[model samples]
Target: MPWTLPSRPSRRSLLAGAAGAAGAALLTGCSGGPGTADPDPAVSLERRMRASSVRDSERLLERYDATAAAHPALAERLAPLRAAVAAHTSALSSSGASDGSAAPSAPAAAPAPGAGPAVSGEPVPPKPEEALAALADAERSLAESRTVALAGAPGELARLLASVAACGAVHAYLLTPTPGAAS
Candidate 1:
């Protein structure tokens, strides 16, 4: 008989075994299955709110980044605003509210900073003035959303949201062009 090593279990079998183990764990509630409920509804609600705020902040940052990329002239002006949004996202994520179970859905798409209809994927290059205006509008909207979420947040989270809202408001104002200003 030819000398041959015993055939090892196929790769598919290994993957199946691993998946089966994971499914068993989930079914047994070892990883907080669907049957599990949060101990405190209020806390759960607060976490959801925080997660939503983080998602909004992240969307705002993406808008800013897209605008800056399309119109390099505005990059310098948008840098600080982007930094502020990034800080808000970092704070919210670090607060333990970004766990997958409670994380909010991401925005469907980030619109280009332009007057025409929003296009997904490839963004239309926008003029500097229009881009800035769009960025300001996005910031204002995010700030409003954050303000609404503040009511449900814990003390520390509330304070953080308040500061983030204030910063967003300031960024919106700063992004607006002054009358008679060069484009």
Candidate 2:
């Protein structure tokens, strides 16, 4: 006689086996199941910051582009700074992150009235030197923003913010007066 194979398990048998396995899993879970099911707060905060930074960078680039066009002299001084921000925005986008929020056409340019740092009463810069000094001030303020944003960021966002801050610092230095350079 030909060897006879055991019949395939019926649907009922398969269901019974599945149920048994599920019961065992449930019992194991009830005993000490993989800790709590709580979500990570850091992950959430990091996601928010990462997204916000992307949006801000995008908006700032556009703003600088527009401001640069409107004020050619200011724009000339700001070109490199704006370019750096554009690169940051591209990096954020490439990293598969960005806040969906549309930044306001004009982000808070000067400090809000009585918010924090007050705008100087000193006369506005009449030359590139003066403009560069002002640019340095703006870059510093942007650095502060990056710091605050990163304080609560997590994972990749924290890393990205650090990079952003370093870039801003570099921009500030670029705007500073070089030795032997005319003010």
Could you say which candidate leads in lDDT? 1
Worst 10 residues of 1 by lDDT: 115-124
Clash number for model 2? 0
**Per-residue CA lDDT of candidate 1, range 1-183, in tens?**
897653543445544543443343333333334575665884776678777777777767677667765666676877777777777787776645446454433333434444233332334245777767777777778777766665555555666666677677667767776555585
Tens digits of per-residue lDDT, candidate 2, 51-91, equal 67777676555444444433455655776677678778766
60 Cα displacement, candidate 2 (Å): 2.9
Give the Cα lDDT of each candidate: 0.62, 0.55
Candidate 1 residues lying further than 4 Å off, grouped into runs, are 1-39, 96-125, 180-183
